[model samples]
Target: MSVTDRPVPSHDRIARAAFPRRRVLQAGLAAAAGAAVLQTTAPAEAAMRREGWIRSRIARMSVEQQVGQLFVMRVYGNDATASDNRNMNEYGVASPAEIVAKYHLGGVIYFAWADNLPTPAAGARLSNGLQRAALAAPGKVAVPLTISTDQETGIVARMPDPATVFPGAMALGAGRDPELTHDTYEITGAELRAVGVNNDYAPLGDVNVNPANPVIGVRSFSADPALVAELLVAGVNGLQSQQVSATAKHFPGHGDTDVDSHTGFPVIHHTREEWETIDAPPFRAAVEAGIDAIMTAHINVPALDPSGDPATLSKPIITDILRGELGFTGVVVTDSLGMAGVREKYGDAEVAIRAVEAGVDQLLNTPAADVQYNAVLDAVRSGRISRRRLDESLVRILGMKYDRGLHRDPFVDESAVDEIVGNATHKARAQEIADQTITLLRDDADLVPLPAGEVLVTGYGDTTTVNLAASLSDHGHPAQAFVTGSSPSQTLINSAVTRSAAAAVTVVLTYGADTNTAQQQLVQALRDAGRKVVVVAVRNPYDIAGLGDTPTYLATYSWLSVSTEALAKVLAGEIPAAGRLPVSIPSQADPDTELFGFGAGMDN
Candidate 1:
């Protein structure tokens, strides 16, 4: 039966029922699982084989079909027939394939919590199945989907086992080698392509000027806009060169806010003049480099738009500022619509309508796909969202798919996934990049090449500490690890102090120790006990500012396994520390005073 003639399903009817704004907008997401495999893809071919394929396709599309093209929904399950509670809760569908068919979806996003990335073969099967369903859906245009994910590498990497795990944007920024940045992302793009994902929401272009930023900290390349701009372009080139569409995200910048937009709205107080110099540079660079897509931040900037609407719903920010001022003609996509930053100001349906009116080309991860789809469909039929507007977004969205070669072939060989992702070459290159990001901030005690004696590795995540211990041991340094959980309690700290009594040297690996007194106490306690204390800020470098007289400290800019291994090598004198601080370290005692300025690092 044709898609239009098919009887409305019960779930669709339920989704269409009237409900309170909060109920419709409420969304839940589980944390992603850790570790996975990887894959590789060929260099991009010429843009869609047929010059006018998108135009021809759009001409034949019905309003309903055209509306579908503007959304990239989230679904649960690793394969077409797979179903789970998360799928039913989020999409009201039985399986991932059913969501694609029922919604006539433009594309679907993969998330680990949704069971969308259990294994490389599983991911390939899901991608291939979704593409088939998209073409087979009755009355729907046979356009392939732009399968996407947040494979930002480092802390945000989603591809599991065997996928090469490289350092994050900040780490690469610390290395300050654009060529290395390009090589890293090229490997990233190849792996994503091998898993059948066509788009990656990565290579953040935000300049993190605020050290107190609760979100975009290590995710950003650097606090220097020029540096961020330089690395962003190389990253974009690398990903697109591998045929995976690269997205420069959180436009107008999300790097200066103390609040995370995922849970709260953040306002950038930067005056227009300051924004021009600080926040606008990277985005300008992205446009010049021909980035494929730009993701909008759900942030409010009064200097640009006095309307109080966040960038996602403000025409002044999106249309006037981005499209007109910056001249970015590429696809403009909204951050997840379910985020509190976007939804707190409007209802679910209104959020979608306003985003489109704001000149956004796509709506990503809406609270409920059916509701937002119907809302946009109704608005289009009523002439509220102009036909010209709808056509503009359709052309851009479809063009992305075509240019990325999704239209030509969206299926990946499941069996071949194991051979491409996390292969020997990718792993070795990732390690090399990781080694380049280790920065030795201080070694006043001259204990860096570490004394020849037993060592105790403690602090932060249990897995991370254990891994560091193993990596150190692998480098011929005898070590034992002590777990101090994410937020180490006084008991845990006291226990660690007692445990370190027998060690010749105590290595405290901190996460966010600048804010956790227990972590600082653990470091101080070991020193008070007359044991040599070496503090390694595995996540953020600001930790040292809180520990007043730390004699030896290092910064890895991330806590990924590869980064930890690199730290082990540096600590064991197996490699020299070569990284510099990507962002400045602020003084905890006096926020006005500088703790350590940017570009502060010393070689071992």
Candidate 2:
């Protein structure tokens, strides 16, 4: 039967069915309690049953197996044990399946380059194979593996062609409807669940305060703490409602830094009060909403933790702030261990031990799974990491597996992959989201209903521009696309200008023109040539500050196909531009002044 043949049941019903109490326990409850007590107390009893089951499972696990449960490792393979895949052979195993069994792994993460997601069916097959290996591991270590991936929709999606390509967080923020955010994530969770991925590392909780932020630009929902918090709660509720665990990531915020943590260490000097007001609200909201997991950021905040350790390895940050102050009882997982943000301060073994010591429940994507496994094992044996500490994380990890229904059935029907992934309903919703996120900031020349003639679409990338042209042509607009590289050479600019002279209207897409003088030059040159130009900021809306005087200007927070296609329909007069800016566009001369304030949008 098709996975979407009927309406999806609520998460409460699904969880109850997946982790039902024993028949004896059910009978005992019926016999011991009056109907009124059972009616009011069933939820409490259910929680006790889940905790009891998790404890029983953990009690059976050996020390080696318990240590393994702390790490969520990654391997390179589509099949169980392909000889061609050798990225993880350091574990004395050739295939991912072999490694899962050899280490008695608690979970595995999928990455595109790891050859783990060629197709939806292949993903299901790989997940099933991994689950089988984990379940059949030796000596009381058999449990289902919690399969996961960074399917955060916009910029970080791993699944190809058939998966619904929804816009990124900034786009959704522009749409500015909490219920829309919820529905979009529900579709995202449904697709991931259909393919057997039980966990999603998504719904960023960062408040992007710095306009110069390098990494968390379009990934953030908005710059306002209250807005980000509102969307985050909706996203968490939406995703978990579909039975796939939702992870609110980069706790303590990665927003104000100009440096990319993946490459360098970033230090945020937000005072305790500033941190509490600007960055901590969304995470507090996620915890209040019962988020399944919270991923730690690798950035350092001196005001919060004077120890100078990154949040991923800082007891004060992870344990004191997140667990104690915020009262988060869910799993606390680290960002990838291989990123330079975490690695620059410590070695591999030290990183693993410190993360566990700092109260991180799961270590993600360690450089070498075997090294981390051995280090953690030795730490536990030597009491550097207490037995209580090891079991504490183990219980959270195991409990999440049971709650997400991974332990009940960790496999997906491969046959249903084609039916559910990128289906018509999901695609239409994606397009609708894209439509709502197209913010038309200005149209002074009133060239929106493009003057009737051939349209010239030129942009920084060939794929991006060509796709926009294709989408335009599909919208019955006669359009031709030209590629102007990020740093467009004078030659490419001259060619695009000459082509623009023959067209009635020219639509130019800018990517990071704010700092790229070459791109800024290209936009000015077109305006200097007296061509009818409409500028669209596709990557960063800050691009608008550079070309602010253009007669017609727009911002689509993402350059993904869904977003560009929505831009095409709007340009073709098929749909109206209805999105508001989620972040303010600061004036170039004075960063404190807004060239285009937040919530700026003009309809055609």
Each prediction's Cα lDDT score? 0.85, 0.85
For candidate 2, report its TM-score.
Answer: 0.93
User: How many backbone clashes are present in model 2?
Assistant: 0
lDDT tens digits, residues 1-604, model 2? Answer: 0011112233344334334565534456656577557766998888898888788878888888888887788878788757543654556668888778777788899999888988888888889888888887656556888888998878878886789998889888888877678888999999988888899998999998787899998899998787788788788888898888889989889999999999998999999999999899888878877889999999999999988889999999999999999999899999999999999878999999999999999999888777888999999999999999988898889888888887668888889999999999999988888888888887888888677888999967778899988988888878999989789999999998999998898999998988888888888888999988999988778887777587788888888999999999889888888778888889888998998777778777
Model 1's alpha-carbon lDDT is: 0.85
Steric collisions counted per model: 11, 0
lDDT of 1 by residue, 201-281 (tens): 989999998877888888888888877887888899889998999899999899899999999999999999999988998
Residue 271 local lDDT, model 2: 98
Q: Give the TM-score of candidate 1.
A: 0.91
Clashing pairs for predicted structure model 2, backbone only = none
Q: Which stretches of candidate 2 lie over 4 Å from their true place?
A: 1-36
